[model samples]
Target: MPNITVQLLAGRDINQRRAFVKDVTDSAVLTLGARRGDVRIVFEEITPDTVANGGVLASEDDSRAEVVSRFVPQASS
Candidate 1:
């Protein structure tokens, strides 16, 4: 059995996870010779407040604003 762990900031939808799981399962099945039933994938979602990169918190990373906007809830003006 092949177990995989994927971690990312929260807010991605079920459709995104579905596609990701499908592709990863396919790769494991083809490259690792793992059976479809034996491939395990786990997703761990981290909130922006809890994740940081280059000493900058994800919630406050200006350089990542565009990508972060997709996940962060936007308040109506």
Candidate 2:
């Protein structure tokens, strides 16, 4: 059995996560000869406030603004 863990800031939709897991599972099956049932994948979501770069919190990091925008809630019109 192969176990995989992925960590990223939250905000991705179900479709994106589903596709990612499918592709990873396919690769494990093909490269490691692992059965579908034996493959495990875990996703860990961290918030911007919990992470920092260059001693600056991600939530306040100007350099990460573009990437962080993806996780920000969209305003309804």
Candidate 3:
């Protein structure tokens, strides 16, 4: 059995995530000789504030924050 855990910023659509999971499982099944049922994929979504880069909070870094913010939908005023 293969257990894969992916941690990423919380912004992707449900369909995107599902497709990624399916692709990963299919690759494992073909390349690793693992059964579809034995391949496991887990996704962990976190906010930019919860992640950091180069010892600085992601929210505090303009460049990093911009990248993460792009994935998040803009809120209506």
Best by lDDT: 2
Against the reference, the lDDT scores of all candidates come to 0.90, 0.91, 0.86
Say which candidate scores most in TM-score: 1
Q: Runs in model 1 with CA error above 4 Å?
A: 74-77
Candidate 3 per-residue C-alpha lDDT over 1-77 given as tens digits, one digit per residue, 9 for 90 to 100? 99999998888999999899999999999999999999989988887778888998877788785777777654578
After TM-score superposition, what is the CA distance of residue 75 in candidate 2 from its true location, in Å? 11
Q: After superposition, how far is residue 33 of candidate 1 from its true place, in Å?
A: 0.5
State the number of backbone clashes in model 1.
0
**Model 1 TM-score, all chains together:** 0.89
After aligning candidate 2 to the native by TM-score, how far in Å is the CA of 43 from where it should be?
A: 1.0
Better of 2 and 3 by lDDT: 2
Sort every candidate by lDDT, greatest first: 2, 1, 3
Cand. 3 Cα-lDDT: 0.86
Ranking by TM-score: 1, 2, 3
Model 1 residue pairs with clashes = none
Q: lDDT for model 2, on a 0 to 1 scale? A: 0.91
